[model samples]
Target: MEKLIDDEGEIYNSISPKVAPVAVQNEMEPSNISIVTTNGTADNNIGKSKTTISLPSAAKFTNAAQKKAPWLKSLFQDECSAWETTKCGLAELIGTAVLVFLGCMGCVGSMGTPPSSLQVSFAWGIVVMIVAQSIGHISGAHINPAVTVGAVVMGKKSLTGACVYFVAQCLGAILGYGLLKVVTPSDLLLASSTSPAETFCITDLHGKIPVIQGLLGEIIATAVLMFMLCAMWDERNANNTDSGVIKCGLTIAALCMGLGPYTGCSLNPARSLAPAIWNNYWNHHWIFWFGPIGGSLLASVLYRSVFSLPQCSLPECQSLNTQKAELYKMMYGHGDMWDTFLSGMAELVGTGLLIFLGCGGCIGSLGVSPSHLQITLTFGLAVMIVIQCFGHISHAHVNPAITVGSVVLGIKSISEAAVYIIAQILGGILGYGLLKLCTPTGFLSSGGPEAASTFCVTMISPQVSNVQGLMVETMATMVLMLIACAVWDIRNASNTDSTSIRFGLGVTCLATIFGPYTGCSMNPARSFAPAIWNNSWLGHWVYWFGPIAGAAISASLYRIVFGLKTHDKETLTPISESIHLNSVDTDKSEVIINSWIQYRVHLTTRVLTLGKLIRIRAPYTRKKVLNPCDKFSHTIARYKSQNTTFYIPISLRCFSRMNLITDLLMRFEEFQNQVYRVRVSCKHLKHVKQSKHDQRSKAKVHNNISKV
Candidate 1:
């Protein structure tokens, strides 16, 4: 009969009803056990069935059960969290909505006697900056669909997640435009429907701006925007710090300002599509989608593949890093109460000065209409003065954007930054309060929104679309940040003496170009303080969003082109200096440096401690020593801990060999009448081992006998 066996290998015998237990068979070897059963086929009449089972040895079975677990799958799940995806999508939505709505409001106010580009820029730039600051912590505020595509192509985001973001951003854009429509008058909307304008969806039948040129402009501008974004976000880049998101907003604002006049600077597809859909204007619609996407993709590919930062191999740079680490640890990890207080005060005082001087110019101009140059200079000069006054103290980072940028580059600590920002905000309120004291109440109220604009960040025209103003601000802020980094680069020697003047000139230049459109506020603090004090929040987000985006872009560009290398030659240096065996036996050397002694001493006595040889000259003219032996030993121990090295100068012709002891005693006694003190070098010294005490004794005796 055939045998039947279960998965556990317990065999059953149908032919033998009273068979040995399966356990007894299992205990025996496989060859010793046998199972007998009925015939293979089941017999219906007899009701008997048969089966045969084969099994691997228990050793082999246990091994097959102990295979490696699937760790890679678990890791993948951890890396891609469902919560993170949802958060990113939501942030994109809010960020886009903020950018679109404020930008539209700025456009609504752009139609005036002169059609100021400055007011339009201000409205758009601030929106970008604020949105970045608000939601940048979540989704990176990639409100533009072009950016989303670039991110995905660069492998920073998953295709599915990026698609989700794009959908959210488009919806957010529609929502922003809807809000703009509700606030705008129908008559004004009709007059400035943008269907007849050549802003976003180029409707110009004239050949002045050929469709090709418009497309090229979009490609170039969007390329620059994407290039900056990639540089800032690259983890390999040393300069891509904590401030990356804000800098991105600033970079966009700068690009927007510079390119607004040409092809309307529609660097974002979502931005263009939002308003186009609202007004039912679709002239040359392909340019917006094709140009930005193509440009951004090109930039992302080129930057990721072609560009790299310069490496540093200097010993000095290594030493500098060590010192920097010490300083950083002291300031952040173990900072005393006084340092924190000083840093806070520096920010407070510096910001106060900036607002008082900057906003004063704007308010004072109420009586006589100041030119854009005057306003720009006022703001730029204010920044310069604060920078110089507090540069050493607080880094004079009166602007929050600059502070964030510095932190990202690893130049500042987060706690210090928090304190600085808080101080500056409070300082801003104080500065505006002081301005109120000087200006007449009637003048402040008489102009209403027009008058309030002088003391606040507001839109001045309504002809430009929110998208158009945002683009202008983005371009302008980008230029401002680019120049700011250039001037601040320590490697550029020419910038050393004229940093303040150069920075002031740079800001003034930006304002002159973009001030008429949007007030040219590259600094968020400069905008926020005035707006808060004046109680004017219209289009305020543009100021924050634009400058921050622009700055983030600049941070990336600076890092890729000029950031310091992570691996340095100095870091490879041995932690402690190695002893030179060859130098010790050289007859050419007479004096040795005693790192323990701060001041120079003659070389007469050679003492070897723990294998380190130290030569000391004692001017002994009398029986008593000028310095106590215990005190000298303590000094040596202290110097040893500090890694200091000392060199002693020796001269053979100064004394006869046989009279060395007598001469040294006489000299030391004579020196006792004078005040001879020791000095230590500012730099740390390397350790040199001294010989054993018994060895030193033997050497002295041998020298004395030889001389005799």
Candidate 2:
């Protein structure tokens, strides 16, 4: 008789009276069993019998089980459902309908003497904000076809999904307008002599605006909108979504106010299409479609290719060592040369665009000068738009002063700062040259002979001396640098959703307060450009010297007062020591393990309570002998019950031996600090106990000597 044992610990006995004793030998494969039997004699009637059985491997059985039931496999998969996509599309449809209905109702002239541009702009902006906030999570609230197109170009949406979104948006828009028509009076829908259109909100060129100028206006305005959307969608700005809807609404309002006079600011093709279909007004309608679509494609592609930051995998992002290495590389200026080149180009283009748009807004013809408020809003919004477009790529330091401040703060190396400064200066000159080429002669010379040395030149007023002008510029630049430093501070990293808006409004505030004194030229590059182009360098040194001094001082002060210190040594030492202590005794091992368990319990409780730490003081129990696998599994189940995610090392999860558990726990860094602290305390207690025992023994020996 022979016995065979299986992996499950079940034994099987084989008996055959006619056969000789059977011999069983273990094979290299655990699943393979071999049995051999020989006859009692060569001439005997009984013959030898050999039987071999091969059992299925556990892995093979598991794979077969998984394949047999696909639903079981899908339980662990993270794939999105078809219903989720349908929900998104439905949300888009409803969001678009709401936007159009509210926006067009606000534009209805029949309600009164016709609302002012500012009123209509605010209405539309508020409506957009409301709709976005309501449905943003469900479908991203892409009420505009241009936004959908931009998402497609950025690879954020599939082609089929985008097509569905477009169709839904169109239908929603049409439905919204139809509902408006149903509610409004019939005479209100008719065209008046002043309107000359059957529809209420048909977008068309105003005054004597040429078709090409209107087209270009629409394209530029829509491009700005798309750029802001792209910035909001970027992964680096993932945490900045709290006020994203408000930003979008304000951006739309600003675009409309700035460009409404020329092109009606129809940045959305669907918004324009709905009204055209209602009133059958198609004159120059192609501008609305081609302009927005073209601009969306252009801006989306540019942002994705040039301004988007590289994203790391989850493992890399979670690794402290990798983060530290990258930080060190950046601080030491050892980053990729190609990235540096791209950053330089971004700075160049960003500065050039700033100068062109900002200075262009300053142009006034004849007696029609732009109002102070207009100038303020223009420069502020221009700053916001430029930053939104290029901030992720190069930090959007369009000024030499900001570059200098960055160098002082250790955010940029000397070489990188030099590259940025050169780019800014060159960009400024190029931008001014372009502005001069485009502006009419009298417009560039708007401020009369004395004040019209050149448009947008940073010159001191008659009441303010060169010294006063320098002080004003210095103070203003200092404030701006302080804002930059705050934005770059680690404490405020998660609160960058409205950075561009904050900067824009800050510029507006400073300019409004100090414009009459020195034109509020806090940027040396901005002042240098007009001075260079106009060949007018009166008190130009003040602009350069004041901003640089202000930047250096502000950067130094911010670093001294507000910088967060990194404790790399303190954070890394415990982990290293724990990893080295692999041969601890059973008592020390138990101490370490118990300490780790306590730490985990505390951590889990704190997380579950949303930062409220809960204290648990339970004595260690040894009623049952549990292996590491059981302990780990129990801990994991407890964590899951509290809705906390805990990851145990795979090796530790299957550990069957105490020594194996100790070895793996020594290498585990999560609870290493607490474990090491407990271990040291245990050793100290042991030393104290040994000293007490020795003292007692010495006292006893002395007592025996006296008694004798």
Cα lDDT of model 1 by residue, 1-708, tens digit: 334445743222232223221211112112312221122111111112112212111111111112223333322233457888888888898889888887766666324432344555555666887887888778878899999878875656766777888999999988887787787665454314443432432222123445765676577668766765665564333322454444454445444443444455777888877877877778787888999999999878765553322211222222334323222222123234455566687678668757765664454223234445545755776665555444544557777767666555555678877887788788877866655653445433312346544454645246666566676677777776666566556566333444555676687787788766776676677778878776787777887777777776776677777873232212222221111211232222222212111121222233223323334432211122343334332222111111223332222211211222222222332232342222121111111013345577899999999999
User: At residue 470, what lDDT does model 2 achieve?
Assistant: 89
Q: How displaced is residue 297 in candidate 2, in Å?
A: 1.1
Candidate 1 segments whose C-alpha is farther than 4 A from its true place: 1-78, 110-115, 190-207, 236-246, 308-708
Steric clash pairs (candidate 2):
none
- How much lDDT does candidate 2 score? 0.64
State model 1's lDDT.
Answer: 0.53
Against the true structure, what is each candidate's TM-score? 0.38, 0.62
Alpha-carbon RMSD, each predicted model: 29.0, 20.2
Query: What digit string (tens of lDDT, one per residue) describes model 2 on residues 500-581?
Result: 8899899989998998899898899999999987899989998999899898889999899877332222122222212222
Best by lDDT: 2
The residue-level lDDT of candidate 1 at 408 comes to 58
